[model samples]
Every structure is written in C-alpha cells, then in structure tokens.
Target: MGSVEESPEEFTVLVTGFAPFKSEYPVNPSWEIASRLPEYLPRKDSSSSTLPRVRIVVYPEPVRVNYQTVRKLIPTLWGPNDPKINPPPGDTDAGRSFVPPAKIDLLLHIGMAGPRLHYALERVGRRDGYNLRDVDDQLLGDTAADRADPNWVWYGVPAALESDLDLDDVLQRWRAHSTDRDGVNHDLRISVDAGRYLCDFIYTSSLAHLWKQGARRRVAFLHVPAAATPERVAVGQGLVVELVRSLVETEWAARQQAGTDNKTDAKESAAAHVPADGADTVTGKWYRD
Candidate 1:
C-alpha cells in the first residue's frame, strides 16, 4: 500500500461534555474544556496543502444526570441507522424527508473526574449499577429498589465494554509534550476504573451504540481532572486537544492504507482467475488456451 498523503481532507468529529453533576464547583471542567476546543483546532486556510481540515462540533448535552435522560438522549444525538426512521436533532413533519449528517468519524465523550492532579484515559466502563446520589441528594441511578425506570441505557448490554482506542498512542503523545502551569509535566495514565457513576454509564452506552452500528476506530472517553483555576483548566484543555489530534491523524492514515490494500488484493484475486485467450468463456470458469 502507498503512503497516506498529508494533504487536506475534511473529517467531522463530535465531542460532548456533560453538565455539572454532583460536584459543588460552579463550573464543570468537562464542559469548559469542550467549549474551548474549537479555538485550538486547526482552521482551514486558502492553501489546499494544509493539514487535514477538521470541523469539530462541540455539543454540550445538558440532560440531567439520570439514567432515564442518558438513555433517551444517546439515540437522539446519534441518529438511528435503520432506513425507515428519520434522522435526529430534528424529525419534524413525518412525510418530509431529511437526512442528517453522516455518522461522526469520532465520538469523544469528556467528563470531569474528582479533584485530582492528572487526566485519565479511561479503558473500561462497567455495567454494574450506580447507587450514588447527585448534588440534590437524589438517587443517580435506576436500580430495582431505587425506582421503576424501564428505559435504562445499559439494560441488556454487556457486563463491560473495553475502549477500542489506542491508549498507548494517546499516552505517548501526551507524555512527549504535555506540561502544567508550573512547567511540571502532567501525569497521564491508563485507568481501568471510570467510576461507577454517570461517567461510566454514558461511556458504556456510547460504546454499545457504536458497536451496534458497526462503526470502527470511533469512540473514546477522557476523564479530565477537576481543574479549579482557569489557568489549570486551560492547560488541561490544550493537552486533551493535542492528544485528540494525534489520535485522529493516526487513525486517518491507517484507514487510508487499509482501503488501498483491500483494493489491491481484490484486483490481484480477480486477475488470478481470469480466462486466457481462446479459453472456454461459456462455462464461466478459467481454462488454459
């Protein structure tokens, strides 16, 4: 396969951040980081030889931190794959046809972890129940004892879904250039526990949706430290953006190579079974002259 050119190619990515949940802090770090991502992403100029043209749409999901809300919104944000159903974000006027944009190439979900010093690239989201309470002192999950919420997101899903992201690649890029306000390198590590709360709930639901649609090289969840100060939040945002860009470029190149190789293999296989001159073409089988 030939090398993937560095020319400009447009790719759409959907990044989502949850609202302030049980935390006491007035501002949610997850939403803050997502709101500022567009400023850091590369912009397209007139020069056609520029880097990949990335159009990132940051959608802030303001749904309440509850099992019912998460369950309903997942399909809304990610439109249905079945042909009979209309696309999402707008399904008004049943007879009128409206096709939503293509399925996002990458879906990166960000949620704020507890007050910590480093960011975590979450590896697994468990299916166990969340029995915690939100800031309002209400139950966050819908277990048998809690209430009869019939539409739980992880109702019949697997026990756990390990992230398909290349964590090693994300970590390598983060360690190479990430730093804090004090010039101290930030600690970025692979984390197995995504917390048995809404974070895990949403992450697991995302993976399940993508899997059902057969979307590859697509989903990842990032846990950002609860940055207290504005400067700290800025630093965390920059690191996260850099890591995302690296992953996107790497995946893009890989897909290009895979496509080229598949075409080449198909051509070779076709030639190998082709009939020679003056062969028995009527039988639809290859024969020597």
Candidate 2:
C-alpha cells in the first residue's frame, strides 16, 4: 500500500473596513483596498505543502461608520449567535450568496487614519474615551456615563484590551515581506493607541467579545492613510497582503514552539513518575521483585 500525507490546515482571516466617514471623505480607501483583496494569500512558495493555505475573507459590505451600527454588527461578524443582528442579504448583483465563516483564525479590522502617512498595527483597543461623534453624529457615550449606565454594553469589559499576538515578531515579518514602492519604503509601525474613534471602538468590541467568550484574542487592527487615490489604494492593498502573511506566519511559529514545550513538559512529568533503580513500584513490582 502507498503512504498517504495529510494536507496542511487552512488559516482563515476575516477582514473588514468602514464606509465613507461623512461627506468630506466620499471614498474610504480602507474599503477600497479590502474589497479588492484576492480570495487567497499570494504565497511566494506556492509549491510548499507545509505552509498553511491562507484564506482571505472580506466582509460583504463596507461597515457603516455609525457607532450603533458597528456595536450591533461586531458580534454578528464573530458568530451567528445574536438573534437581533442578521447576516447580510445575498448579493443579487453578483449572483452569489454571502455566508460568514464559522471559524476565523484571525479577525483583522482596517480603518482610515486621517493624519498618518505610514501604516500602523494597533496594539491596544480602548473601551472608553470615545467623545467624537460617528458619521451619524452620535456619541458612544462619555466615560462617566458609560461607567454609570448599568445597561451599557461595555459595562463589564476592561477599559483597554491588547491583542494577544506578538506584535514585535509580526512587525519584523511584515517588513521583510513588504517592499518599497515609488521611492517610498513602506513604514510599518506598532501603535499602542488606536485613536478614540470608530477604529478603537470596533477593535475594543472585538476584543471584549472574545474575552467574554473565553476565546483567544486573535484580533488585529490596521490603520491606513486617508488617501483614497487609485495609487494609494493599490499600495494599501499590497501592505495588507503582506500584513496578513506576517500575522499567519508569526502565529504558526508560536503554536509550533508551544507544542514543542508541551511535549518536553510531558516527558519530564513522565520521568518524574518512573521508579528509581532500586525503588518499589506502587503495584508492588520492581525489576527484581
């Protein structure tokens, strides 16, 4: 009989971007870049079977830039548990049905950064201090009000939650995979603050949801420049592709290390239970018994 080999597991990433932020920004580059992503990660070594098959699943619609809309939408994206929030309807124009992924290896939310000229991977997601109004001119509630409101959605959640992913390792891998274009080296950075806007709100919501569920905080938020030009959008897309690749690679490496450590610990634990050369066993049996 011939030997059989199992295929590599697939790593699924769910990405989302917000809609235009009011009339001033008629076109949001975040959505422009996300909507154009390829279904799968473009691997440099496509023939390598050991590498996980990275699947890129972008949310069907540009998330409305409304605080309430986002607060309702985050849970649905994570799972189909919320009866109040329903899945997006099928796209009649595209002639295809949109089904959300049951399991996501990583949830990546991309939002526009008006003043930033470089790409940033936010390390922290704040639950409070959102004073700015969303596109609908509504506040998420002041810090005091949120804390005082017993019915507040984020009442029990922490003020800030950081992603569990190793940001330092991810950044290194991202930079290595990314290339300079148009005489500009893509300046990738790690940001502690995600800005107290819809970006931070959405990020915090994702982290808190996973926390409440006792799940791994496998989430990330990327901040891209405000420029929505075709050229800029293309660059953003490239950065996102590389960023996804880095995230997957780093996580896989961490898992591999953890598995190794667990095996070593198991061996040590087993050795500790073994009887010494002359010691009697619990069953009253020994080498010379």
Candidate 3:
C-alpha cells in the first residue's frame, strides 16, 4: 500500500446563490443566506479542531443560468484541473494570509421561491419538456438539452436525476432545533418539482455531475420561500445554517471512520502476508448518506 495521507484538520464546503434576476425582487433571499452563512456556521469540529474553509459563490449575473453555467461551476467547486473551466477568484478571510484552494466535500445551492413558509427539498430534477420561461421570458432548460453547449448535443442521458441527499434527516435535524418567531413550526417539503426553470436546470445538472464524480461528495439544492418579514429571515437563516452544519459534520465523521477502517484493514492484510494489489489500502473510494 502507498503512504496514507492524514485527514486535514479542516474540511471545506461550497455554498452558492444566484443574483437578482428580476427588478421586482430586489434581493434574493438565497443570496442573503449564502452571504451570511459562513459567519454563523461552525468554524470548528466537534473536538474543537479547526474546520476547513467555506467557499461562497454568488453569481451576480442571471444570463445563461442553466446547465452550461453549472458545468462551468462544477470544476470551480472541485478545483479546476482542466483549463477550460477557470476557477473563481481566491478568497481570503480577514487578517489571514491568502488561503489555498479548498478541497470541497459537500456542496449546497440556494434559490428563492414564492410566498410559502416552507422549504422544498427537491427529490429529483427532470429534463423532460416543460417549455417554461424564466424572468427574461426565456425557455427554461426543461426542454433545451444542448442550449448550454453549442458544440455538444445531449440525447441519451437520463431525463432526471434524484438529489443525493437524505432530506428526511436534514428536515428532522432542522425541526429538532428550529422554530419561527410566530411560534408556528416551520415546515419542510420533499417534492419532485424544482420549478422546472433555472433552479431545476442548475440543480439537475449539478447533481448529475457530482454523482458521476463519486459518492464521497454530496450535492443538493434548496428552495427558500419568500422571506418578506424579519421573522421569516431569521428562521430561514437558522434553518440553512443548522442543515449545513449537520451535513458537514456528518460527512467529516464518515471520512474519519473510513480512514480508521482503512488503517485497520491495511494492518490485517500485512499480518496475513497478503499479496499487494495496485490499490491504496489506506484510502477508501466511496461514501454515501
């Protein structure tokens, strides 16, 4: 077996939000939450070890908000090994030296929705035709397969992909600790629909990409209902932070366990004098939740 690389003291997460697409909605609540989450998220692990950096990407433009954008975005989150995808600008925490690129383990995208006081945890995103239009009256990616890429045509890929998240666990975690100012219980809904617009377009494409990569990475998109009141904002913020924290902690713990298991397996194999194969005995290849 090759040398085992120890787990880093910090683990990274990438959170993203879209910019305002229409004038009627001046502020995207999703952006508001994404912009503020890092401050509220846990910066340390359960053992008080330093947590990895949280990279934030806020797309300021609404143009081409579809699969193509996400195809480009994926490499950035994962760090661009391919030159075609330019990594976003480097981020630096205040007073700290320039931080190196983050090794992302979990990813979350936030988008705004209408006047419902609930979160829609999308179960699946479909590529089936909808002919729905976006803020600019453009046909959503629901029907256009190759609109994002002029040179490539997509024909045989699955029409839909399920979100790789145990949303029930996320909802349960949120309910355990979160409550609205009105004393009414906040609600979470699991649905197949992601609006069949840019939201679904991005979500489906993002998850498909991550799924192809591996199970070690988790991806999900959240639809935040319109937050017109201070109470709503507070609840939304709390919900987002808790869910994110829970997911990150859970992923980190699994990685640690896999590391331990790999070490034990390697020792056992060596004691038994097993012939070595061309494999990293200390590096687990897959994880799921």
| Each prediction's whole-model lDDT (CA) | 0.60, 0.75, 0.55
The top-ranked prediction according to TM-score is: 2
lDDT of 3 by residue, 16-90 (tens): 676566577677777677666653355433542434543333333222344455545555555444466564432
Give the clashing pairs for model 3: 10-52, 11-52
Per-residue C-alpha lDDT of model 1 across residues 177-270, encoded as one tens digit per residue: 4542236666777666788787887787778776666555266788888865789778877776776675566556556666978642111232
TM-score of each: 0.70, 0.80, 0.66
**Over 4 Å off, model 3:** 1-7, 22-24, 43-71, 87-101, 140-156, 179-184, 214-217, 229-231, 253-289
The best candidate by lDDT is 2
TM-score, structure 2 vs. true = 0.80
Q: In model 3, where is the ten-residue run with the lowest total lDDT?
A: 279-288
Worst 10 residues of 2 by lDDT: 263-272
User: Candidate 1: which pairs clash?
Assistant: none
Using TM-score as the yardstick, the better of models 1 and 3 is 1
Total backbone collisions, model 1: 0
Q: Supply candidate 2's per-residue lDDT for 93.
A: 28
